[model samples]
Target chain A: MYKLIWHMAWNALGRRRGRSLLVTLMIGASLWGLLFMEGIYDGMTEQMIDNTVKSDSGNLSLFAQGYRLDPSLDRLLPDSLLNQQILRTNPLIKSRSIRFSHTGLLATAHAARQVQIQGVPLEEEIVHAGLSDKLAQGRLHFGSDGNGAILGHGLAGKLRVSIGQKIILSAQDRQQNINSLVLKVNGIIRSGNQPIDDKILYMDIEQCREFLGVSQGFSQLSLILHNPDNTALLQEQLLRELDDSAIEILRWDQLYPALLQGRQVMKTFNLICNLLVFCVAGLGVWGVMTVSVLERLREFGIMIAVGTSFQQIRAQVLLESTLLGLGGFILGAGSGVATLLWFVEHGLNLEVFQEGLQAFGMDTIIYAIIRPDYFTTALIAILLACTASVILPLRRLKQARPVTILNSQ
Target chain B: MDAFIEIAHLHKTFETSREVSTPALIDVSLTIPHGDFAVISGPSGSGKTTLLNLLGALDSPSKGTISLGQTMISKLKEAELSPIRRDRIGFVFQTHNLIPVLSARQNICYVMRLQGRSQQEQESRVAELAGKLDIEQLLDKHPDQLSGGQQQRVAVARAVASRPQLLLADEPTASLDSTNAERLLDLLEQLNHDEGVTVLISSHDSLVINRARHSIVLRDGRVVADHYERNDIP
Candidate 1:
């Protein structure tokens, strides 16, 4: 019986090909738009987060509890076997390094600016800091003695220095005395970040330690994760292992509240956009289905009069709507994937509108990402819309008097 | 056996609007034995179609008990009426009302399919009915493509394909010309006498009234006459 009804439903759709085609096209276009929108938006946000993590925060960070509020020499964490052991034992931690950042002044022949000097071990930073990848000039190496510095793009602009230029960096020593050094620029990094590019500098961690006259202390332990999703678990485990009252652990969300809030806003905005698209598609399907049902009023009456249960008729209608939605869903998903692949391969260049995108902290070139779940979500949304559309038509079916329907011309 | 289909004290009324009750059927009782070819003749507003609707389980009586086979259907819900109709009763309407989407063959076989008959049973029965109704050549043609007479032939084939205990047709010949009307009435008679399918058809045409083996004349929602007729071949 159910099979017969299903067959009938399919035939009904085929018989009304024009209406069904119109409905399918409406839903398919909406779904395709939604898929593209979701992919692009998610890709944009994902790229931003990934660049932020890669260019700066290593997914997780350890700091002396009060150190971020006050970046002072005295708050430096001691470099010990405990730190080394924790890094060594946890397989989830991809890489760990010590960083000693201090505020200083950089002066050159043409310019002068206050700079935040970042100290990294050359070999470790090469693999982990992605420092090597960001090089816009010269080499990433600071040499063994740390007498060289890599300038951020904006800092280089401000100091009027590039690779091979000489600059003077001066800061207070650990003992509260002013000390200075003359260094040549080793590399220039373009990390696409405003603050980091404008006022930050990178040098060898050992050299920064020597310049500060601190042999056993470092500012914070930075960690890169194999899978960033494991950051919270690792942070919890690391916190328990360390048991230090002076130290705290942080995840990317906690470390970057503003970015997290931005991602949330984008998500909600995408949801609203998708809902609007769904509403349009839903109204199309509903409008078509209502007309289709009305046009077949007499046929439905004959069916009911010939002993077709209302339940069976309702199922048949639901099946028809579902198949309609499935058609659109499949078409939408197929084209969505194709478009995403094209975007992923060639990238969508918005360089013409670069300033506008940059204002929102987005890269000029947008690469689309395909997440399978988005297709699932689109399918579910369409199915729900299609099913919900039939409630009124089904009610009409129930109230249909066989006599009246049959008697009508 | 208790009448193949029995109705007792059946009543139906419609509320046209507030404070007005118009009776359609009143104190109607009927017994139709198996293989009976019953024709109901009445003028418009005389309730022939209403009685057919009640007997087919398409509508319920306001106050009555209707037994088809063993199930009492008049008091049963629509859900219960469905299978009794699908398995034991078939309907033909004033307009052939063949499912427009289906071809003549599929439309004829639809009731059997609803009863979950096997594919082979459906094919054999559809083929048998097509041949009997002389619609074999029109099997693949949809209702709109078929002539009115062809559509009614398919409708009758559908009605008898399930071999139900009773077939209720309301104005089965209303849409037909005289020649086609005779063709359909002849088929209905063959279904009654040759196939032994009990048939109750509602019509007002004197030609139909003259052809019925048993004639039921209704007036103002009551049965005024019931008897066998010496069917005149005119």
Candidate 2:
């Protein structure tokens, strides 16, 4: 029975080919635009969050409780705390980078800038964060003497310095006395993190400790987890089990709430966009179905009079709309997936807006993220829209009496 | 003769607007006996169509009763009336009203399919009706592809394919030429005699009125004549 009804509906749609094709294309084009926007925007957000996590804040960061508020040389995380068994032996800790961070004036022959000088072990930094991959110029090595510095590109551009140039870094020591050291610019890195790229200067940790007259203590221990999803669970476990009350463990989201908020806002915006597009597509379908029903009143009347129940007619109408919607959905989803796949492979290079993109801490090239849920959500939404669109038309059909239609002729 | 359809003082009014009403049928009482080839003949606006509509269960009379077989159908709700219409009565409209999308074969088999007949049954019925109605060659064509006469024959085949007890046709010949009109009447008479199906039609065509086994004439929404030309069943 359903097969016969479907055949009838299919033939009816074919009778008005132009109108049917027009509605299908309208829905297809709208869905394509929606899918493209959602994929690219999500890609951009995730990339920004990824950059921050890799370059500066790992999945979790441990700091002296008062150090973030004060950042003084006196508030360093003690050596004993840094040497704890869990910090070194816990399976959840994939890698850890010990860093001494201090505020300093970085001076070149032509210019100077105030920067956050970070002292890190170059080998561990590479293993922990793939730091070598972010190098924009020069080599990742800091020379054999360990007196070499890796400058953030923004800071380099500001200081007008280049690889192999000399720079002076000055900061207060633990003794409250100002000290200075000279370092060679060995490399430059661009991590796509605006704050870090604009203000960071990296050097050898031992040299930095000697320059600041600090020994056996570090400011922060950034720990990357084997599974990032375990960050919260590990943090909770640590908070409950650790004997030390002076150390604080913070997740990436807590340390950078803005990125998380940006991700959430984009999600809401995509949802609204999906709603708006599907609603308009649904209206287009309703218009076509309503017109089709009105034009066929006599035919429907004759069917009703001859024993075709209203329920059957209603099913036929619903099937017609669903076929139209599904046609559009297949077209849109096929093209959408193809386009996203291409972009994922080649990346959407917007080098024309590099400066503007950089200002938002984004890369010029954005690769789209293709998720399974996008297609499923669209399928469900289109089905619902198709179903909802037929309500009024079905009502109109039900109210049109067979007698009136036959008599009118 | 046993009455297949019994009508008692049927009345139908159309409310044109809030301030006015028009009477289409008034105090119409008639009986159509089983296996009777009947015609309701009248001038335009004489309620022939309205009376047929009431008998077919397409519309309810404003004030009166209609009994088809043993059921009082005038008071039945729309949903309840559907089964009676489907299994007990069939309607052929003035226009062919063949579902424009389906081929003549599919259209003829429509009601049978709705009745949940087996595929073999539907196919055999279609073959039998196509041969009888001379629509065998046109079965593969859609309604738009067939002529007015051919379309009407297909419509007739569709109406009776479900083996309804009563068949009602409203102005079935009004749109056809004389030759097509004669052929349609011949098929109607043949079905009525061979299948014992009580056929009722509303028309002013002289050829149709003259051929009826029984005729009812209406004027000004009231019946003026109820005459039976041949009362003996074959």
Candidate 3:
């Protein structure tokens, strides 16, 4: 009986091939589009989070309790014994980099512009941070000279200086006195972050400390954790260890809430788009099933009159809709996943619109990534949409009088 | 052979217009015993089809009782009526109501399939009925692919393929030509005489009534004439 009912369903589909294909395409194509959008959004979120955490704020940052309020040299979190103990004893800390970050002016033979000076211990940064990977040109080094320096690529372009050139930087020392330093352009970097690439500069932490005339002071201690998610727990642990001193521990989300909120907004937008697509797809299924039942009413009446049970008839109709839904899902998901695979290999480049995207803190190149659960969830959603679509036609079946239908045309 | 169908004071009303009820079968009673070759003849809306619907348990009567063998079916729910329709009664209709999607053999095997007959049993019965009806070569063709007569023959074969205790046919030859109609009537008569399958056929065709040993004629929703003509069958 089951085989025969399936046979009927199959034959019915074959009889109306165009309508079946149209409905299947409606569901499948929309589902594919939804999956693709989800992949791109996920990729964008991952890229943003990685760039923010690895390039700027290392999963967590340590500051003096009043430093964020004042941001003066006196407010800096110096190398305290208690803070060093907390940083060393924590198992979640994978690596650490110390830096003295400040804004200064870069002067060349023909140009002078505002620039950011990040005095970092280069060796520790290579071990702990993704800063080394953002190098678009030259090596990630301060050159052979001990007085070597690195310039953000955009700043180098603006200065019209290249490797082996000399530049002058001047900033206020810790004592509110102006100090000047001359360094060679050892290397240049572009971290795909516009603000960072355009104006940032890098030098050794020891040099920065000596230049600032501070014997044992560091501006910030950036902690890279083995598990970034452990940032909150480690912060709480550090607070516990310190007994509420003048130290502030910050997680990546807390340091950069804009990224988090942007991701949330995108997620909500994707969800709304998915709902709209599914609604249209579901309506297509309902329309096709309605027409199918209407076209076969006489056949159904005959079957019911000749002892095909109503339940059995319902099964055939349900199977027909299921088959249609399944066809669409497979078509959509199959093509969608294919596109996702391609995206995982060669990322989609938005270089033509790079300037527009850069203004919004987005990358020029976007890669797509998807979890397995996305496909599973799509299958369940499509199946439900199709199953619900059959309800209207099945109700028609339930209310039909075989005698009356048979006696009429 | 002791199986019988008894209908006592059957009534069916149709709502033709607003706040008006028209009677199709009015206080009708009928008894069809085992192995009876009976024909129900009538004019349009004369309740011949209504009586057949009641006897087959397809519709509930307005105010009467109907029993097939010992099962009281007039008041039974729709759910209870299907098994009787599936297991005991088979139907053949005027339009040669073979499922257009299914081939001739599949249509014949449909009711037997519903009865949960084994594949081998279904195949053997289809072969036997197709051979007996001289439609063995038309088994693979769909209903539309066959002639009016061939579709009717396949329909009759389906009605008997399950070896049902009762076969209810409504205007089985109404759409056929003289020759095909004659051939179909001859087949029904043969099934009744040979298989002892009680047959109740409703028709406007004289050929149907002339071929049955007994007949009940209805008019204006009443049984105006009911008789047995022994000479008609032999």
Candidate 4:
């Protein structure tokens, strides 16, 4: 029975070869557009998370309670022996570092600017944050006394400071006293993200502590876990091990809730775009099927008159539509993936939107991030849309009377 | 012999529009004994085709009983009627009505295939019928490639390929010229006489009516005349 249906479908399609090809191309183009949009959006979100976690924030970070909302010097997590003990017990803790991040004023030969200053131990920062490899200028070095600093390229330009130039940093201490220190710029780094490049300055922990007049304490401890998804599990473990009164555990995702939300909104926007593309494709399918059915009305009548049941005729129509849809989806999905790869390898230059990106703290270059799951999702969506578009034609074929159809022809 | 087909008080009304009801057949009854060659003759719009459809079990009467073989056809569902049509009945239409996609041989074998006959049996039967119908030369050709007379012969071969108990043809010779019509009627008459196949044909062509042993005339959906000839008139 299945073989008969297939043969009939093939014969039906063969009867109108030109029209069938045109319909297949229309469906394939629409599917490719929708799949491409969804793939790029997924890729971008993945890239954002990877870049963020790899550069500064690890999978999880620990700070004093309320430190994220208010990064005052007074909210520093008091360094203690018990904290070191808890850090040792977690096997999934890949690497841990202490980072003191705060706003400070920097002055160079040409100008002065406000900057986000992160102070970490030179060796640990180099190992955990890949900071040494990110240097685009002079080599990152920790002098024998550990007092040098690294400025981001954008920040260095704003302050007109080059490597080997002395810059003065000033900030208030936990005791409410103003403290200042002079340090040589040892290197320049670029992290792609505009705001981070424009406002971040990295220095050794001792230098940061001396500048802030906090000789004995650091503000936060940042831990990088093996898996980001286990943040809640590790957080639970940390809570059980540590005294709640001493420090707080925070996941990087929670710290940047707005970023995650923005990413989610972008995904939803892409989904809506995909759906719109599919709707247009579905209209094309509907048009093709309606025309095909109308053209084959006489053939359908003859088959029914010759002993084909209504159900059999309906199945044949559906089978033909499904075959067309499957072929289109395969072609479209392949095209979409190829297009996404080309875009990913050569990113889009959004230099014209530099000002807009700057306003939103984004980079000027946009890269499409492709993933296997995105392609799968797009294929599923295309198949579903194609199947849905055939409903009307199938129903029409089912209800049509052979006598009327034969007479009509 | 038992009546191979019986119809009692058959009525068919077609609703052409929302408010217009046209009667195609009314109070029409018929009985065809086994091995009888019967012809139904009437003018245009005289319900000949409608009656043929009803007799073939392709349709149902509005209010009547139709019994074919031992089964009441009017009471059977569409799925059940298909098997009876496949094994017990065959039909031919005015246009040769061969499935254009299949070859002449395939058209003949299709009914046998539907009857779930063995491949060997179907092949042998198709070969024998195609040979008997003199369509052996055109067996591989599609219906579109054949002449009207040749196509009608293939149609006849296909109708009898399954050795059905009854064969109903609707104006099988109406589309052909006089010479082709005569050839087709001759083939039908030979099948009726030599093979003992019960044949019922609907036609207004006098050439066909003259050749049939029994004739039924219909007017306004009722039988106006039912007569049997004492000798072959054609």
Candidate 5:
């Protein structure tokens, strides 16, 4: 019975190759649309995590309790040695950075934009801040004279400051004294983040201490863990080691609510795109099945009269639908992956939208990233859509009577 | 002779969209002895086909008792009716109705396969039937490749391939020329005589009515005349 039904299905498909191919292509295009959006979402989220962890917050951060809200000099960590020891003892903490951050005056020929000055050990900052790799011009030099600073590219443009140009930074210390220093812009960095690009200034730890009037004290310590999801484990271990009164641990989500919110918006946008794709694909399935059923009514009637049971006939139709869906998914997945790989290797240049994207805090260039799970999900969705479309036709099959069908002519 | 098929008090009616009921078959009863060649004659829309469908178990009468062999078919469900058709009944249609995608041999062997007959048995039976029908040379030909007569011969072979106890034919020679129609009826008569297979055919052709061993005439959904022949006329 199965063999007979299969033969019938095969013959039916062969008899109408052009229509079958058209349906398959429709299904394939739908799958490709769904997978392409998913790939972009996956790629963007991954890039966000990488940029956040490698360039700024190292997966997680430890800050004094009130420092996140105030971000003032008075919220400086009393002691850095205990937190450093705690971080070092935890094997999950792959690397760590201790820094003092404050908003202060930044002067250049073009402008004097208020900037967030991050003070860190020059060598440590180079390794953990993703700063050393982003130099747009000149070199990073933490001279022993304590008079050098790194400016973000966008900030440098606004400041009209170039390499070897003099800039002044001013801030009040924890002791309530106004401290000022003159510094040379040793380098310009481009981090691809609009906020970071416009407001970041980096300097040597000793120089920052002198400018901020902080004597050997740090405000926050950021740790890069091997796995960011192990936040609970790392927090527990750090609490056990550090005196809770002097030190506090802050996860990245708490430290960057805006960034997290932005990510959530992007996720919701992707979900909407996914829903649209599903709807379009499901409609394609329904359209194709309905048309095919109508076109093959005579064939179906003949099969019924030939003693094929309703259940067997329905199974045959479902099998054909499933095969079509599987074929489409294979083609669509292949096309989507190929397109993503091409984009990943050669990113799409959005020079036309550069200004607008910059206004929205996004990069002009976009790269599509393909993930294994996205492909799996797309395939399952296609199969489900195909199955769902065939249900109506299968029900129709149950009510079909051979006598009525044969007499229709 | 023992009745091989008995249909008692059969009634069937169809309702149209305007809510008017039209009778297709009414109080029609019939009995045929084993190995007898029976012809049901009627005008267009006179319900001969309806009675044939009821007897073949393709449909149930609205009210009647139909017995094939020892089984009461009127109360049987569609699922149960299919196996009875597969194993006990053979059908030949007016237009030869061969599935165009399959070769003549495949069409002939289809019912035997449905009956779970072995491949060897199917092959032997198909060969014998096709040879008897003079279509052995055309077994591999598709329906479109055969003439009207050849197509009907394949249909006849298909009908008897499973060696059914009864054969129900609906205008088996309706599409054929007189020569081909005569040839097909002759083949059906030979099968009835040689295999002891009871034959009931619904046809309007005068040739078929004159040749059959038993005749039942229908008019306006009711049987008006029934006759039996004393001698075989080939």
Candidate 6:
């Protein structure tokens, strides 16, 4: 009996080729637009978060309790923290980099700007953040003399200094004495992080320590965990074991709340888009089904009078709507998956908006992420829409009097 | 003879959205015996269709009781009436309301399939009915592909294919040419004598009325004449 009803539903849809095709394509086109928009927007958001994590904060960062607020050399995390057992033996910590940062004046022959000078161990910095990949021009290595410096592309642009140019960096030492050092630019980096690309200049840690006369302390220690999901767990364990009075532990999201908010906003936007597109698709299904049922009132009446139960008729109508929805879903999902796969392999380049993208800490090329839940959620939503779309029509069918329907004929 | 359908003081009214009232069937009482070939003749709005609809359990009467065999159907809910309608009654409409999407064979086999009959049973019954109605060649055609007579024949086949104990046809011959009308009357007669299926048809045509073994005449929603001729069966 079910097979017969299914066959009938299939035939009914096939009979009205134009209307059925119109509805199927309408749903397909809307779903395609929705999937493409979601994939690309999410890609853009994830890329922004990834850049912030890699170019600046690792999964987690540690600092002196008051250093974030005052950012002075006096609040530096003592070098002894590096010898902590968890820092060296814990498997959760993938790699760690110690950074010394201080606000200083950078003066070139033609231009001068105030920038943050960051002292980083070159080999460890490369392993932690793929620093070499950020190099836009010149070599990533400093000279054998350890006097080479790398400027953020934005900072380099402001000073109009390319590789091989000599620049002077000046900052107050730990003894309250002013110190200045002359360094030649070795590399320029564009990390696509707004703060990093706009205002930071990197130098060798040993060179910076010698120049500033800071022999034993570092400002911050950033840890990259093997599994980023374990960051909070490690933070919790560290908080229980370490002296929280002297050091503050912070996750990447805490350090960059705006990036987290950006991700949330994109997610909500995608949800709203999904609701709107599927609602319209549901309405499209409703419109076609209502017309189909209304036009067949006489036939339904005859069916009812001949002992075809109202339930059977209802089943037939529901089956028809479901078939149409499935047709649209298959078409839309096929095209959507293909498009996402292509974009994943070869990223979508938005280089035309390079400056705008950089301002938001987004890379010029974005690779899409395809999760299995996307297809499952869409399938469930579409089936629900198809089922909900037929409720009114089925009620109308049940209410229609067989006598009146038969008599009208 | 045992009563196949019993009606008592049946009344049906139609009310418009504006609170206007019109009566479709008045306080009429009647009894139809098993295997009787009957006709209800009346002018339009005289309640012939309304009477057949009530007997078929397609609609409820405004007042009184209708019992098909022993079950009181007038007060039953639609869900309860569905099984009675499906297993005990079959209907043929003037427009031949064949489902447009289904081929003639599927249409004829629809009700039996709904009853969960075996595939072999549905096929054999469809084949037998197709042969009887001279629709064997047209079995593969959809309703739109067939002529009016062919479609009406298919409708009759669909109506009787399940072998319902009671068959109600409203103006079954109203749209047919005289030859087709005569052929349909002949088929109904064969079912009545051979299958013991009680047939009730609403019609105003003299050709249909003259062939009935029992006749009821209505006017102004009231029965004015009813009589029985000699039974040809038994």
Q: For residues A197-309, could you state the per-residue lDDT of candidate 1 as single tens digits? A: 77878898888878877776777677889998898889888888875588877887787888888789878987898789988988888887887787898888888877788
Query: Model 1 off-target regions past 4 Å?
Result: A81-83, A108-110, A143-147, A157-166, A175-182, A210-216, A356-361, B19-21, B63-65, B177-179, B230-234
Clashing residue pairs for model 3 = none
lDDT of 6 by residue, A203-320 (tens): 9998988778788688889999899999999999899888999999999999999988999999899889989999999999988999988888888887887777888889999999
**Cα lDDT of model 5 by residue, B181-230, tens digit:** 88788878888888888999999899998887899999999999888865
Q: Which sequence of candidate numbers ranks them by lDDT, best first?
A: 6, 2, 3, 1, 5, 4
The digit string of per-residue lDDT tens for model 2 on B128-218 reads: 8888778999999999999888898899899989988899998988777888788888888888888899999999999999898898999
TM-score of each: 0.91, 0.97, 0.92, 0.89, 0.92, 0.96
* Each model's chain A TM-score: 0.91, 0.96, 0.92, 0.89, 0.92, 0.96
Q: Choose 2 or 5, whichever is better by lDDT.
A: 2
Identify the runs in model 5 with alpha carbons over 4 angstroms from their true place.
A78-85, B113-124, B136-147, B231-234
Tens-digit lDDT track of model 4 for A1-409: 6666787778777777887787778778877877667656655566566555655666777777777778888778766732566687778888888888889889976689998988887678777877665677987885667768888778998888898889988877767777787878888886655666788888887777777778666766777888777878988988887766667777777766766887889878987887787788778777888878777777776666656666777787877777777777777877877887787887667789876764554545557876676667666766677677778876776666555566676
Off by over 4 Å in 2: A407-409, B177-179
Candidate 2: docking tier: medium
Q: Find the candidate with the highest lDDT and give its number.
A: 6
For model 1 chain A, the run of ten residues with the poorest summed lDDT: A78-87
For candidate 6, give the lDDT of residue B79: 87
lDDT of 4 at A167: 90
Cα misplacement distance, residue A111 of candidate 6 (Å): 0.9
The better candidate by DockQ, 1 or 2, is: 2
Which regions of candidate 3 are displaced past 4 Å? A78-94, A108-113, A153-166, A242-244, B1-3, B19-21, B177-183, B193-195, B231-234
lDDT of 6 by residue, B1-234 (tens): 789789999999988657798998999999999899999998998999888889888888999899898899998988888889889998887778888778899899988888999999999999888887888899999999998888989999999999999999989898788988998899899998899999999999999999988999999999998888766633
TM-score of 3: 0.92
Residue pairs with backbone overlap in model 5: none
